[model samples]
Target chain A: MRTRTLYMGMIAALIVVVGLVGCSKKPPPGEIIPPPEVTPSEMPQTERVPGDETAPPGSAAEDAALQIEDVFYEFDKYALTARARDTLTRDADVLLANPGMRLLIEGHCDERGTREYNLALADRRARASRDFLVAYGIDASRLETISYGEERPFVLGSTESAWSKNRRAHFVVRQ
Target chain B: MKPIVHRFSIREPEQARAHGLRAGPFTVALLFWAGVLTVALLFCADAAAPEIDLHGTVVKRTLYRVPIVVEDFAIEASPGERNDPLFFSGGERPEDLLVQDLRFSDAFQVVRRRQGSFDPAGEPPRDIDGALVEQPIQARVVGRMEWDDERLRLKAELIDQGTGNRILDREVAINREGELARPDRWAIHRLSDEITRYLTGTPGCAATRIAFLRESRSGKELFLVDWDGYEEQAVTGLGTILVSPAWHPSGERIAFTSYHRGAPVLVALDLESRRLATLSTAPTPAAAVYSPNGKRVAFSTTAEGDAELYVARADGSHARRLTFHPDIDTAPCWSPSGERLVFTSDRCGRPQLFLIDADGSNLQQLTFSGEWNDSPDWSPAGSRIVHVCQIGGRFELALIDVQGFGWRRLTVGGGCENPRWAPDGRHVVFALTQAGVRNLWILDADSGNLRQLTASPDHSYNPGWSRPARERIRASG
Candidate 1:
């Protein structure tokens, strides 16, 4: 009987201890448990800003009505083809019609070469176009040349048709 | 009660002996007290004993990733302020930027707590056992963003989970005017680099910037971007073709080939003063690189009717030809000691890598395996040369030892070229094309880990990595 009483007392003490531990005070008010890091949200889409010159200005549509054709070059060659010279002759005629107009000849290349080398080649192409216009009785001061290298393609696909269109010197009119 | 006492009472020694009993209550009480004393002594001994020191043997692994936890950022707005204007609408948050930087570092495995969880404001827990529950977080980073009247402040703390000690705490600030003038990414980059240094014992690449060519409708202009691809800005707005941008060792200037005057010429731009100075007066000058000491420059020019390498003072004076080969020699990269150069030449009937003394004495071919190899850049440690090699009509990056042995191809893709080594000598950043779209990619030299650094829809090529400006200053000092 004495042993049974001791066992009952120990069981009661354990129950009280467990109850006390469970009823412990809560954390202080206004304390926040920091959230986990590394939430994988969707990546923001890159949007072109309004004054970014990723493409030709909207005014180029009006200039395209002038019927001045862009000049093309052969693959890996900056020298103008015979057909390219013929196109430049007509562009020179357009420049002659408007003496007050200044022309920006943007040299471009197809996406098939190294960037730095293509840059040099495009520069040569632009200068070639400028030289042809200067020799065709157009004022040299009215012509400025820039090379876009393989950047700013006229078409997006990697086809021969697209590459042929991209490998050209486009003329833009500036007043 | 009297009957129970009598029943429980112990007999005397003579009565116990007769009854075959061992002892009475006195002896029993004594033995119980002795047992209690022994247990108490054991408890005392355990409390006063010193802890055992354990030394573990380390096993070398091919790759070891440090586990780190990034806590959600806290915003502390100033009086009357509602939000931070520095962050773009729907763009990356401050914590996002930090996480991106850590991920690209390839040194840490970042863990994030559940979304919308609140962090208790105050000091972090004082012991690893106190902070961790289920995850194996080795380190934790907590950040707070404070915005007040045109000024933005970012405070970050790096805590070591093992010791529960705060390893680093840094605060960065940027003004509204500065944000409008330049992207505020630099401040975050500086903090990220500090955190990396605290964790890895070496600085991170966040402070390094890359200069590449961006195609504008008018021309291809040189542009600059931070290593994380933020702060995209034009370095030169000359409305002409520019290429081959090479950063000076000091990171204060850049030399590139520009066609502003109708022909290619080497031009140097001072980043701070925004001054443009022509470096080459020749008709065609391209591919300029600075010596390791930043005191001299070497470039290729066609003034002699063929492309040949030339060396000049940093100020573009005292120019002299470095190579007299009849074949074309371009893309001259100076050795780290500035005693020799590795350049591309076609003297062997095709473009190949050749090494020559700084004064143009001992000419030796460095590559003979590839039919074409060009754009050779010497490693910062002067132990290897990385160049673009043409194999099966596709361009790939190849690394060759300085002693001309152990040639290794680094890129699995055929459209990788123009590999430039990082200042740490363990990473190389180069241009890679996939599906005809060119972007910049970085590769780890030892582990062969590859990561795409840029993901712009437009083409980004000709990347030039900068040395950490802080490290450069420390070294010079």
Candidate 2:
């Protein structure tokens, strides 16, 4: 009975110590960037802000038209989830709407795996998005791909909430 | 023994303090007891099993550190020449560096004069019966340095105390040019390695170079430094993402993945010519490693929408796919014999190490314990594979034999990654993160001693230890 009590006490102490260490090691919260604009046809168009005076004509309109949502993946996985496929389907609609727009599909991963493996995984994630769009009738020539690996993280933390957002295929409409 | 225990106690509590936690003495004592219990259990479990000799095992073995008396080099001036102050007023003295190298080698422990004083340059005492005096020392090293015309010359000798025989005599000269025109400490490094080789039969790692990636605000770039982490030289400034820097067998070229042209590509850089060549055939290549013979290259590419292992000639011709997995298969490292490769793949549902023949036959899984394992580098002896294993949600360096019988974690406190073996096969250089700063560290495989090789503020990782220059010279000579 005494041994059991000591074991429980030790376990509780270990948990407390580990909790403190883990809390202290949390990466400082980074600048929170808004998620990519998901411009579904059913949604109301957002009002253009008043800072459009310095922009070229029609470029702002093109940027708004090319706004597509980013598709995310699980840890160390490149296979698109069902939600990811739906997002890419909507992304394909935006690509089809803007015929002159060329999309740069940027694959990114969280800071977890080895750099080399992460780079390759990121490439696969980007290519998966591109392949899905092409299969959805978007022209193959309209999309290009690049992998930032873990070098660029969308959200800078090791938590699952941040990692889920970081592991994604980000879209940038090239001019 | 007391010092060792004190070091452990201090290091553990200090690491806890670095986390901003107020670990009181009671907490520290509890933690130490917990650690001791855990280690005792592990040791008991591991000791119960008989040794397995499938490949070179990281199994615990008895360490025999040779006791040697090392003397400060006697500085000698050339006949009729002034003792130049220029030679003395340089960076690190040769004798100090030799002592540091000997200590770092872990094969010899320098006996302090307090233990038993002896004249290293003087002859040993002989009894009246023509027998040598009794001493605990096994060997002695003595050296002298003098200024030759345009170079500084160092002559060293290693004498065996037991047999009273001279084991080695060597001389090294360094030219006085480049970087303040100082006598290069590399001459001392060469002598240390020579002495170590003559005594231990295996070359020391002092005179080697490690290629690693240094991250900056712009991007990650390749940098080269000595084995002792001096003379930092930037090899590439592409201002783009670079990873997996690999040294060719000849130690004259480096291949790495670069995102210079908007896509990941395998690029080779010639150190002497400052030339870069892209292996254009590989689509989105990463983790390019040269074969043991330097005639072939194995790399991972995404030519078919999914990453797969591919092999080609060293010049990037006659490319052929070596794996047909739909799952992600990448980071292929060549075995010592170049007949097979050990790589990471997710075909097993999670990332695990898999070994396959060069012709893509007889594929087998090598690790099944870790949740994730990747970036395996085969040791030069073809016996062990060191890789990054995820334990407790943190990456640590782990070693496994070729036959997949043993699994051993080499580091603790996590944040260890990208392990590569030195040419000596007894030392491993890997990246370790502490207090949020990543630096390069070396692990003595035999002694399990960890030493930081680089402590830069910027992140440094992906270390590739090159063949020691002395070995190349000896091979050619």
Candidate 3:
């Protein structure tokens, strides 16, 4: 039932995102900038993003939109669990539906690991989630990954419960 | 033996005179009234009056005598306690409280009273015993215990055996029924510390813990450890890039940064609950931290594409931009008082020490000699700031007093990067490598005696000392 709700949100996010195919703007090489004005109706009718071939056009209208319920990890390990797989599948569907959708899989860990190592571990974890989704047929280009390490914890207690919740990978919608 | 119950204060003499208390003869009038009063009343009045010194002694080591006389030491029991014969398990009572403390200090050669009655005035002999080569002296630790409302109070004292004089005294009045009451172990440790101070003029380890960061190829994690580097436990295990773990006003929580996702975001991890909370990830990731009580943190960020200094609460609130027109300001440490922040900035062509207020005012450059001085860890007593300054391609831990003077080297030119203070402010912990083996080492905050803490397994990179949480704040407040 929860996945169903997430699917609904994914569909809504896709409809709006697919309308932004290759139309998804990016800065020129070597500069960091945002997408400029592009009409939803003017989006290319190709199977992929016009300028960005990595995007799958009209996939947002398919059964590709997935839902993910924050997947958490153990103390310092970045490998996802069986339960985390379920969430990743949902997120993959969302990425698959909107070829124009670029995702930033933010990896996170609890406050039990070192800062630098956790950053790398979180990156691995985020990549783990992204790799699984891509293997499930989602385009890698549309999916971006980064790690915040144990620096950004969702919960703020030094208890097992808090640590469990903090060691996780959070999904964020990209422009 | 009694303490000379004489009260002297800045306002004592004037107040005593105003109250018509003259120096003629306080004992004479008191004796005259005591003759008409009962013994209990007489004792009560005398308890508050100037106490008479039946005996007093102070221990001092001599080139000739290791057996320095110590005063105010005695042993006593209240009906039944750890020392009762009924609890004796071996040659002597294993649970004897004072005896255990006496042995732990390793300062004295304790001699227990013989089974015979104590000869209060009988001298043992003119010649010292040959077997007693160390120190030949007797100590008596007396504890007066009372129970009230289910709580126990123990007032302790120590003295020289021969003179029966008071040398040192302390009290542990515990109300064990409440949540705030400390554990018996804590009280015992405090008691042991008082004894050490009484003998050595300086206190020994009793109330102390170590904080360190475990480093690995994957990520660096923060850990809290005992002084012996035992009981080591990870505090922040967010397997991401972690840097500069600082004890919050509450030692139970720590403020640090973990690059879990993208940018270096500041986080606070509660040591007890193992919970992690992101304090700030918006506007820009928190660079450094001073807790909400005003402990300043040193953060690395690029507000202008060059990493700069910004102070924020350990909880990620009440932040203020501390440096402007900066080259690259980072690593801000809060003085124990939280009034000033010591940090590193490249404002002078390279990283050097800088001082500023919590609100970003009172900006002043601190280091003039070092080419690069980074990682400023403010002393727990607000006495000095410990940091690393580059010296001929290598870095050393240097401590600059609060006045930016008395700059002294803590670690000789070596691979020391970070310098953190122990709770008692006597030692510091840093990371160094030999033969390409990186490890954490502890150093005397005064003498700079480098002692390796963690050798193998995963190299200890950045070590953060854990100051007691409540004391961290009270020390600053």
lDDT of residue B99 for candidate 1: 75
lDDT, model 1: 0.70
Ranked by lDDT from best down, the candidates are: 2, 1, 3
Question: Cα deviation in Å at residue A33, candidate 2?
Answer: 34
Winner on DockQ between 1 and 3 is: 1
Kindly list the per-residue Cα lDDT of model 2 for residues A1-175, writing each as its tens digit.
7656666777786677656544433323452222223224312223332223233556764665446889999988888999999888887887777676667788999888898889888988999999999999988998888777898887866678988889999887654
Estimate, for each residue in B287-376, the C-alpha lDDT of model 1 and write its tens digit: 889999999999876576456788999988998999887656788899999999998876776678899998999999999876778888
Segments of candidate 2 deviating more than 4 angstroms: A1-60, A63-66, B1-62, B78-91, B112-135, B177-183, B473-477
Pitting candidate 1 against candidate 2, the one with the higher lDDT is: 2
**lDDT over C-alpha atoms for residue A157 of model 3:** 63
Q: Could you tell me every candidate's TM-score relative to the true structure?
A: 0.61, 0.77, 0.50
True contacts recovered per prediction: 0.04, 0.30, 0.03
Each candidate: what lDDT?
0.70, 0.76, 0.55
lDDT of 1 by residue, A1-175 (tens): 7656655665575576545433332223444223222112311123332113223445543464366678898876667888998888888877787676677788788866555445545666777899899999999898876666675678987678998998988877665
After TM-score superposition, what is the CA distance of residue A53 in candidate 3 from its true location, in Å?
14
TM-score of 1: 0.61
- Candidate 2: give the clashing pairs: none
How far off is residue B29 in model 1, in Å? 99
Give the DockQ of candidate 1: 0.03
